[model samples]
Target: VQISKKKFVADELTEDGYSGAEVRVTPTRMEIIMLATRTRAALGEKGRRIPEWTPVAQKRFGFPEGSLCAIALRYKLLRGLAVQRPCYGVLQFIMESGAKGCQVVRAKSMKFVDGLMIHVGDLVNYYVDTAVPHVLLPQGVLGIKVKTMLPWDPTGRTGPKKPLPDHLSIVKPKDEILPTTPILGQKGGKPEPPTMPHPVPTA
Candidate 1:
């Protein structure tokens, strides 16, 4: 079954008795496009639409027409609706390492939005790291909790809250321990790195 492609949809009601999303298809494969209601409102305020096709994704993944979706996922893990622009950050602390996992975040760069400057906290998001080749995180000594950008912005404030970030709820942490990595891949940093499938003792 296909998901609704209507704009400003709270949720698409799929037909029953059919297997819903049997697999966790990447953003490119599924005919269904999920969206956060908060993003829809934000885009709607600007007279934009949702459930649209991704132009770049189509070129990269080579999927069928109207099969892909350009969802406006909330930037909870990155920043609160800050300047509505992308910022660079690293994973200061990671929930799971060496695998497909959520990305706990800290802003490596800063920006101003709504007349205030936002900073980092116990917040995180999810991004597949292309460099390290594993689900990677920010590289630093501090740890913070961040959340996934939800369908709605409950707090309304752009700055990060003091509690654990929201994305953790989507991807739960394993009993496994994650290790620490220094800037530029330096080995002489932490005592032990538990993020890997096996632990390595530091010298």
Candidate 2:
């Protein structure tokens, strides 16, 4: 099972409890790296549920049988949040989960705090983790955008050497609960500088 060539995909696929995936190849075999909100849900308990997607991927990508290995890593804030307090919960979760900083944005009528959640910007291509889940408000439907700076190393080798700005890092948030820290935005004031994580390998 020596591989002569390889292919890698980043953030191309996302599903419930699943955020993204990557493909890696070694001389011995191929590795399918799955990123999800819950490893158990994505890989199943003890991976007894791998058959659910393995065949699909193998056929879609044309990988040889028995040569592909599927594994999962966990991330958060992968899903959208509801309105009001749930938004606050997101902020708290990201910070508590080791994010350097975080922010939430919504319509002018639904202010989480006075100035914290007001500022806005074009985050369509921002590097950090973002979610634009829609909510049904009394007035109409509105979209809530969440952005956070996480301590993730995209390269997965020796972590990042320098500090990543709030816009460039990944983030995680737990169950919907009010977050204590003020939410920052694209045009918001600079947040406190984040401490660098120890240099180590990441998925």
The top-ranked prediction according to TM-score is 2
- Model 1, 1-203: lDDT tens digits are 12322321223222212223322345433333334434444334332332232444345455432122112222222223332232122221122212222233334343212211123532322122211111123543322222222122236342233433343446676787666844543575556555757678999
Per-candidate Cα lDDT values, in order, are 0.30, 0.45
Cα RMSD of all models vs. native, in order, equals: 24.2, 25.7
Question: Could you give me the TM-score of model 1 versus the true structure?
Answer: 0.16
Model 1, residue 175: C-alpha shift (Å):
32
The 10-residue segment with the lowest total lDDT in model 1: 126-135
- Runs of candidate 1 exceeding 4 Å displacement: 1-51, 55-100, 104-106, 109-128, 131-203
Candidate 2 residue 3 Cα shift, in angstroms, is: 30
Score residue 55 of candidate 2 by CA lDDT. 57
Report the lDDT of model 1 for residue 192: 55
